[model samples]
Target: MMHKPVVDENERRARQEAHLLVREFGAEAPLYAAMKAEKAIEQKDFGRCARWKRVLEILADEPPADLRRSAAAK
Candidate 1:
């Protein structure tokens, strides 16, 4: 039997939160998160930077709006 990798609870929560943010704010959500990450880098707040970077990573994996629309229209 093949076993699926276990997801950490915090990581799962972050992904869910990122998706909700993207849905609520639309395409610019990732852009905003990236800007924050850049600001964090300037401030030398590596932890905050890491969190925002992770959010961008999660956002990158989300389906594009066009793909979602096409699938829905099918």
Candidate 2:
């Protein structure tokens, strides 16, 4: 029997958010979002930084925006 891969809630959320952002912002969404997170970090806002970091975890593994657009087109 084959085992199903375990699903990660954070990863799932990141992908879904990636799709939404790509659609909304086109090519720049991922970088734009990352910049926002970076800004949060710079400002020492732990709460916002934590939220963005959580959503951005798998974003590096996944392509920034183009991959998201192609996958959503399917």
Best by TM-score: 1
Cα lDDT of model 1 overall?
Answer: 0.72
Clashing pairs in 2: none
Off by over 4 Å in 1: 1-13, 64-74
Q: Of the candidates shown, which would achieve the greatest lDDT relative to the real structure?
A: 1
TM-score for each of the candidates: 0.62, 0.54
Q: lDDT of each prediction vs. the true structure?
A: 0.72, 0.68
Give the per-residue lDDT digits (tens) of candidate 2, residues 1-64.
9998986775566566666776776666767668868999899997777667765664555665
lDDT of 1 by residue, 1-74 (tens): 99998988757655655666666667877888888789999999997787788878877876547324443454
Q: For candidate 1, what is the total of clashing residue pairs?
A: 0
Q: What is the lDDT, from 0 to 100, of the residue 30 in candidate 2?
A: 60
RMSD, model 1, all Cα superposed?
5.0
lDDT score at residue 5, model 2, on the 0-100 scale: 90
